[model samples]
Target: MKRLIHFAACLACFTVFLLGPTIASAGVSKKAQSDFEKNLLGKDVKALLDMPAYKDGLDLYVDHKVDKRLDERGIDLKDLSKYLKDKGVGVERDEWVTITDAKIDSDRIEIHLGGGGEGHGASKNAAKKGAGYKRAGGSRINFRYGRDLTDADVQADTFLPLLGRVLDTSKIIGVVIPKDVAPQFQEAIRSRDVVVGMSYQMVLISFGEPDQKKVDDSTDDSLHETWYYLKDGHRWVVKFVNGKVGKVQVF
Candidate 1:
C-alpha cells in the first residue's frame, strides 16, 4: 500500500513536470483575462485574436432591445435602435441576434445579425415565411496585429466598430467603447490625432482607414508603409514603421 502511494505521488510530479510549460502558456495574465472577460466576450460582437471558447451555437446577448430593421439590414442592433429613437419611433423588443459561430479562426470573428439556425427550425420557418425573409449576412472582422493594414481591409473592419461607437455616443447599449473609456475614443476621433504609441486597433477607432496605402520596400523592412487619407483637397499622411505610427503629416 505504501509503495503504491509513493508511485502515485511520483506520477503526479511527472505529470506536472511534463505539463508545466503548456500550463504556463495556456494561463492568461490576470489583466488580459479580465480584459477578455469584461471588454470582449459579451460586450463586443467581434474579436481579433483567439478568445476563450464562447460556445459556437450560443446566442449573442444584447443589453438592450433591438429594432426591426436589424432583421432586414443585418446591421448592428444598437444602430437600428438609435435611428428609431432619433426618429421618435418605438424600439422593438421581440428580436435578438444570435451568435451563429463565436469561434472564428485565430485571426477573425464573423458575426451575422441572426444565427444560421442550423439545429433549430430555421429552414422550416424560412420556407413558411416565404422568400421575402432572407438569411442575415455575416460580417467578418480581422485583427491588424500591429501590421501595416490596407485601407480596404481596415475600412471593412471599421463597420462594426463604427456602429458600436454610434451606440456608445448615443449612450444606448454601449458595446464598442466601455462607458468609462467612451470619452477617450470620442475625444480622439474629434481631435484627429493618432497618438504616438497607438495600436492598429486604436487607429481604426480614431480615424478609420485612409483612402490609400503607399508601400516602401526599398528598405530592408517590407512592412514599412504610409497610409493617406484625403480631406479638403489635401492629404493626411500617416507613416508606419514596424506597424506602429511613426510620423503624421498633413499635406
Candidate 2:
C-alpha cells in the first residue's frame, strides 16, 4: 500500500505539471499580468541578476506575459528590434559582441562586454591580456554577471537561450562588459539615498533609472513599486504605507 501511495503521489505531481499550462491559459489572470508588467516597467536589468526569486519571476513573466504579448501583437524579430529602438535603446548592425571578463559577487555576477573601439580601438592589446576575443566594432559591451550564469560561459551557450534570442533578434551588438566595473557600480548603488515616492528622474540622479518598472496596485501595503536595474539585473522594492517610505527590499 505504501509503494502504491508513493506511485500515486508521483503521478499526481506529473499530472499537475502537465496541466499547469492548460489551467493558466484557460483563465489567464489580467490582474496578475498587470501586476507583473507594472513591476518590470523601467526596471534595471542588473537588479534582476542579483535575486533568485526575482530572476525566477522574470523568467515566468517572459514565458507567460512577454511571449504572449508579442504573440498578440504579431511581433517578429524585426518587430522586436523596432520596439527596442523606439524605446531609445541602442541597436547596432552586423557587429560581433563578446564577453570580455566574468566575476562572481555576493548575490550576483559581474561581466564586462566590450569590443575594440574608441580608446581601445580594434587592437589585440586587450586580448593579449587574456580579455577574450577581439572584435572589429571598436566598442565593448559590458555586462554585470549574476549568480545564475551557466557553466559553459560561452556567448553562444545554451543555458540562457532567451538572451541569445534577444541579441539575435535585435540589431544591437551584444557583449559582456569588464568584470572590474561591478565593484564600482555596487558602491554607487549603495551610496545612493534611495527614497520613496521618488520620481524616476530623482532615482536616475542617484542610481540611474531602471531599465524597467513593474507596476501593480495590488502589491502589499509595504511595497509601493518594484524597480529593475538593467545594468546589473538587480531590483529594489520601494515600500510605503501612508505615502512614506516604510522600508526597502533589495533582491
lDDT of each: 0.41, 0.36
RMSD (Cα, Å) of model 1: 16.4
At residue 20, give the lDDT of candidate 2: 86
TM-score of each: 0.27, 0.20
The lDDT, on a scale of 0 to 1, for candidate 2 is: 0.36
lDDT of 2 by residue, 132-245 (tens): 332232222222233233323323232134343222311122233344434444333333545544444435545556666655476455435556563222366654444444
Candidate 2 lDDT score at position 204: 58
Candidate 1 per-residue C-alpha lDDT over 139-197 given as tens digits, one digit per residue, 9 for 90 to 100: 22222222222222223244334334212222213325334444655555434446555
- Candidate 1 stretches with Cα past 4 Å from truth are 1-175, 178-187
Best by TM-score: 1
